[model samples]
Target: MRISMWVVATFLLAAVSLEAQARALTQNQQSVCRWGSDIAAGAQASKLSGVSLYGARKKLQVRKFPRPWMRMTALGITEQTYNSASRLKPAAVKQTYYEQCVRHELARR
Candidate 1:
């Protein structure tokens, strides 16, 4: 009986640990998605205002860029201007934007 109780206790602890890990992973993924979306929007917006990526980065700061996801979309529409001017690929730029957004959001929290 004692052996059975010990096994059950161990199983419960393992299950709890697994649950915690899963929750943490889910939160991390959600954060990444949110950040990427924000960066893309910001990039698009900057493009619309005739701001080069370098100029925007300098002016807004990567973390302070506004409506990042929307900006990214705008860039997508005007690929020639941004693509020719920026050193980064669109996806890479978007990821960097997202990372910055995530950091800023976390700092705010």
Candidate 2:
């Protein structure tokens, strides 16, 4: 009985893990994620380049990134994330963006 219970538990865990891993971002989603992610990354990284958060957003708008202002609104990066992570090194910022974008997209499904 103990062995059977353990096996069942293990099987259930495996199934749930596989299901979570199975959902993938579509091609368009990959593109959109990259677009938004890069924009956010550039904005955040700009602090090192001497740009303020507000300045970065305006520059992005003048350069025509979709919803530059709204990226901090609901359904996107929180202001806390934008503010706190402003000084992350470029590589770390990129990984952070990729993970956040992936998690958000997956949860939307």
Candidate 3:
């Protein structure tokens, strides 16, 4: 059970790595970007503990996040960002996402 959970977590991280950069995303998109990157970081941390991201893709499991639907949207964003910049490392990708997310959040304040 624990192993599966870890696998799911790692898979989630794997999917979440790589965010959009170079081009700007709308505020709404940035919101999702932040969330997905955050989730990816958590997932990466979980992997360091030997967790895998194999089983966490299901909606029921995704409810661990505040908004399950949003998480699904995050997956889409993560995938798109990752594909757009496959050459970049995950850490760099997360940093870019973080910067954009922070900027978007700060503007609202």
Top TM-score prediction, candidate number? 2
Residues 4-101, candidate 2, lDDT per residue (tens digit)?
Answer: 99999998997576445434778776766666666556655676677765666666445534555544442234234456735677666765676677
**What C-alpha lDDT, on a 0 to 100 scale, does residue 89 get in candidate 2?**
74
lDDT for each residue of candidate 1 in 1-109, tens digit (9 for 90 to 100): 9999999999899767644543444476555555555546556656766786677655444333355564454344344435645655546666555454444544555
Candidate no. 1 TM-score? 0.35
TM-scores, all candidates, are 0.35, 0.58, 0.41
lDDT of each: 0.55, 0.61, 0.55
Each prediction's RMSD over C-alphas, in Å, is 13.7, 8.2, 14.5
Candidate 1 stretches greater than 4 Å from native: 1-25, 60-81, 84-109
> By TM-score, highest first, what's the ranking?
2, 3, 1
Model 3 TM-score (2 dp): 0.41
1 versus 3: better TM-score goes to:
3
Which of the two candidates, 1 or 2, achieves a greater lDDT against the reference?
2
What is the clash tally of candidate 2?
0
Pitting candidate 1 against candidate 3, the one with the higher lDDT is: 1
lDDT tens digits, residue span 46-72, model 3: 334444344323422546557648666
lDDT score for candidate 1 against the true structure: 0.55
